[model samples]
Target: MSGQAVLGVEKARFLYGANRVFDSVSLQLDAARTALVGENGAGKSTLLKCLLGELELDEGQIIKSRGLKIGYVPQDVPPGLGDKTVREVLESALPHTDGGEDWKVDVLLDEIGVSYETAQQTFGSLSGGWQRLMLIAAAAKLAQPDLLILDEPTNHLDLSNINTLEGWLADDDRLPMLIVSHDREFLERTTTRTIFLRSDGAHSFGVPFSRAREQLLHRDAADAVRRQLEGKEIERLEKVAARYRVWGVKNDAFHKRAKATEKRIDRIETERTESYVARERRLELHDGEIDAKVALRVQGHTVTIPDGSRKLFTIDRLNVAAGDRIAILGVNGAGKSMLLNALARAYDPDQEHYDGQAAVRFNPQARLVYFDQKMAELPLRTSLLDYLVAVDGATTKDANALLAKAGFPYHRIKGPIADLS
Candidate 1:
């Protein structure tokens, strides 16, 4: 810890129209590394925008140290940012464009372990995890940022890359960072400071995330104890008030005492601490028996690029049983997505057929629902309820119920689909 604040927000309040997203929020980014975490739509990203000076505080102010350069890696790569080589992407990220052997660029790439060969590959061609690493490398090196802000940096990262990032954070790079990620292990490994954003306010825990969570458990326990005590006190006061009113109905002394006790009860009722609610979500698999034993089959299937000259893979047999679970693992350019896409296209209701695959068959009883890793098919601009409703003409009320069952809070049902994280 430097014991000096790199960034500060004092008495800050942010609003969207009439809704106050953050109220009287005051915090300091002092440590070399910090984490900003909250449930979906708790204004974590908004606060990050406040820190980066992208969004102005509607009430208070943001204080930044002089000569501070902030680097930001958003949740997703910018739209239309495909087909460019990694080197070109890094070059574009730099303050000044130059040659491959640029001293500063090389130094930053070395810091992230992005070699010249990997740098030559198309940025868009890299796997999701590699792309995440590349983006981090670009943000860390290109801006030469004193403060780096990453939004869900571990979203697509594999185990190896997540470990790599953890190691990168553990090193004494001396770069102050405020990363917004829900990866608990990653946060425990990387950030020393955890700022938990709640709906009412933000709680800053000056410890690792796991320790912070333990402290939160303690606090919640303490709050429960205090609440129980308060409840008993209120009950006692109410009993006293009732006895006094009944014993001396016409006396001013008894009336005064009862009224005072009632006032005290009101205060206690209004000032109660918010109870902690534990959240648990799980997917319940159905026990229905499929009509067919073989849920899917692909015989002599080979996926190739559009050029038809490059062979991705040749599968002699791919038979998925009704209850079978399969995992596809491959390095970059290894056709994991291609294989899935081919299978999904094979089962498309539109009856679309690809030129490469010899045979693609699905059981008549089996229905395929492919969830893309990017979720690109989802409507980003729509609200969650609206998106679900529009998907199948379901009522908004029904959609809201579905989302609630899926663990979305009632307050968050109206939030934009793209901003779920």
Candidate 2:
């Protein structure tokens, strides 16, 4: 709330060829941790890239205080760091100094309550939540950046890990941060300022996420009402101008009044307030229906690590009927993903791979689709249109129609999926 401006962008505009991601966008960051929120594909990630100089704006420029340092944590762990030890990964953030700064890593880890034994393991061996937390710790503690930028920091984190992150971010040191996250509760807990990135521009507020969102909605409503009033005034002026023109046929003096009224109408139209109403997009799900009461059955299943190193948990019996919605809950290493993977692998539409003694079974008519939370299955380089067309039974026309329905512009269909926000 009371801090110097560390970084900013003024009247920024970025375009992917003909597709504009955001226009006239501008915001400044200070000492308070700020939440940068918007709907998916609204260029939140793109804006961070622009701020970090990873991407160039088509128009406008980035502003940073001289000698400013920035620490950035992406949504995903960067590639090739999986095999490195956690200590090595944290050490990478440090500048070369006399002797070394490796001791700082242990101190930071101890402060965060991560065990020393875990530090020696490969970075990828840790749980997804811990990996993200370690990266953030390295950035905040080791890098000593003037401003820290985090993109989706709560992603893949369990409730406990999320609380840990909230505490770390809300520390009394008051490090400057620009956090892009969809987690409203997390933002409200950790951030003091909020910036809403919309297509028209960025709106900054000196309040937490919920309060900032309320202010934004109120502003939009006020603009809408003002526009309506302006429209009515323009209509009234037009009618008066038309009447004046008719009267001018009888008196020359009325022609000047008609011209004056027409000019006022034009002025009102020119200065009219423009409000943004985001386009509607639907994430359509498959409407496939199984013609059976029981869609899946599981019995005597021992869930374990993928390599069968050790058992995680055991399930005696479970049945999922058609229209039944179930949630699997667990902490970080509780085999929730492993159980899901086992069930997804066990689904056999042909019903030829299983005997009556199978641990998992699905109805003959049951169809299955597994969505990996990391989205590793998707080919990032593939165009959206091509990816959609590659689907079973999907024609090119059908793919285009689906993309349109999902609110993707035609120009974006040819762009790689990685380019999507």
Candidate 3:
């Protein structure tokens, strides 16, 4: 954070089509591990692209030092890579029309703490955690660039993979990095500085993420107190001036003094200290009113997934009341997954529909939304506004209002759903 900056952005501005993303933004980046953090649709990705030279500034300048090599870790791998092995995946990272060297693969695999023997497995066959680690390692090893950029690296990683990434980031000081992540602990452990993108502008803090947030909150609270005290003083001065004005009708000298008091009140009001208030973007969720007395009920509810070997689950009785919160817990190979599938099918235990061997009942008006442990299949090409309009319970105007409630601004709703943060 102390050395001369290798990159400088001066009065930077960028626009997506006609919507202005950044206005007169300015910042400096030296050889430091910096974290880029902000709410969704706050232009963090756009700024990163500008830094990487992938996007051009609309009305400002970016000064970069000579021969500034940048390595970018991709947010996602291409779908066709599922059939490739780990070694093949790493080798493909090179510009190979005919052939490429294999030693680079071993070196990067070792650097990322993966054994060479493990490279024989198909890249897609590994757990999501290991896939992300290997993908990052491959991208990093393609070229030992001076600056490495990672965006949301923890997206598919598990706890163990996340710990591995933490070690990799903290492994050296020589590597300058710009990391964009929602993982607060990862930013705290890796980044030396943080840049926050807000509606007002991009603000840089020479401290860890959590510490910077704490400072912002504390400063805002103090400003609130000062504003409250100043409010009372302003009110008192106005009342005194009003009383003097009433007396001025009877005496001439009182009128002159009343003018002075009015001037004093105007000075205080005009020259008052401006307050600094921090804004937060959040979505509030509420469980609306459920009129049904009995939302769902089950009697002798049992489930089993058979591989022609053993029974997976057998429940004696299960009951759910109105507004009941339920959680299913089990280890690998347990029937937790099967239970959910059974609910979706509305199946009974004895290979029959509802009321076969087990009695299952549900209110006809009840609706459910399920989030499986897989990426949602969204219409990536469709605009967010269009997608929301397609969904039930809201008109186009109502959809936009709901998006506002969820902290998304009006201009961004017309963009593609996949482009949304």
Candidate 4:
């Protein structure tokens, strides 16, 4: 796993509009399997796009060894249509056509639990899970490319398919793979290195995801301590300045020394002050009594498709009591989202039919407050105090306290979020 094809960047810079995503960022990726982990808008995808040569860096160069073939499975796959079947999709990854080697396709499909009859079926007709499985098999069937890149590859896959992919990824003979996945278990099983992209930029760690997380937390703690020490030094300098001012009124010798001391204090103040970094916030459920009384009740709910000929889904009955912290779990297009929308409507009946749910105070998943790794939604143009006032309706004092709780320095409350990022 050592001294393999080096994929790296030097002084990399990326910009989107006026926003600078990465400034002087750099990292190295070697032969070991690596996992890219970050929150929604943390530029993980952007980094991958750079690696795939889909997007060029604004101010740096990415160098890969010569003749490196990269196989990429994007986050979104093209609609499974046209003339391609499951077998054909897998075969297309190969350099030359081997139409006669039907057994190879059969073995792969069977290993992934897809029957030969199923392979003959049109890709368009299959469910999302099956299509995802087919794509995984296709990627695996490719002759060892120099690097394999899979972005959110587990999205629509089932447990079995994920396990199969995991086993393939864990193989020693397989080429180095860069996987962007939120599945902690998958990262633990396959990746030997973890690269975390933050608002600051990309950082590579030698350890796996779990260990990398621990290392990051420890680093933040140390940083906090360093900032605190700097703050104390500032306070001590301020005290010396005050003492000098008092002495300057009484003695001529003291007055000259006080002026020099005041100048030194001013210089100290001008030095860049260390600001505390905010850590990730975790949700804490309130400990309160929940009555058995149902907060929401849905019965015989069904959504008609746009064509008016097909029913997307039908749920016979569902109930949710007050204080129930429930997660609606299902694959994409599985009607879990539709069911939530329907429930919101049922709870709020004052609005029009078009306004699905108006009565219940349902926070849409997209609208729920999230402090992602990139802090994209943060008010970059305004100060931290202003941003807090805008988002949480907090006054200056309350906002400062909140920032402190989130590990921000007192002086940084007036600093612009853009500067922090």
> Largest lDDT belongs to which candidate?
2
Per-residue lDDT tens digits for candidate 4, residues 1-421, read 2236568777788876556666777787778888998765567778888977899999998988777777788765675453577777877766557566556766777776767776786775555666766676666665446777888888766576677777777665447888899998889888889988776667788888999989887876886787677677778877876786788798777778777876776776677344435455443445344344555555566754334465777766666566667865655435553455445334423333433333333322212333332244666779988888888788878877777766664555676776552
Q: For model 2, what is the C-alpha lDDT against the true structure?
A: 0.86
| Deviating ranges (above 4 Å) for candidate 4 | 1-3, 79-83, 98-103, 241-276, 279-421
Colliding residue pairs in candidate 2:
none
Between candidates 1 and 2, the TM-score winner: 2
Residue-level lDDT tens digits of model 2 in 1-421: 2345489899999988788899999888878889999987789999999999999999998988887888999998999999999888998998665437878878888887778787898998776778888888888778877788999998877788788777777674468888999999999988889999888899999999999999999999999999999999999999999999999998889999999999999999999999778777877766458888998889999998778987999999999898787887666767788898898888876877777779898888888878876777789999989988886569998888888888887888999988887
TM-score (all chains, Cα) for each model: 0.86, 0.92, 0.69, 0.66
Candidate 1's displacement at residue 71, Å, is: 1.4
Give per-residue CA lDDT, model 1, range 222-256, as digits (tens): 98888899989999999999998886677889888
> Candidate 1, residue 6: CA error in Å?
1.3
Q: In model 2, how large is the Cα lDDT of residue 391?
A: 61
Q: In candidate 3, where is summed lDDT lowest over 10 consecutive residues?
A: 347-356
Cα displacement (Å) at residue 313, model 1? 3.2
Off by over 4 Å in 1: 1-5, 17-20, 95-101, 104-121, 278-289, 305-309, 350-358, 390-397, 411-416
- Compute the lDDT of residue 46 as modeled in candidate 1: 89
lDDT of 4: 0.68
Cα deviation at 59, candidate 3, in Å, is 1.8
Between candidates 1 and 2, the one scoring higher on lDDT is 2
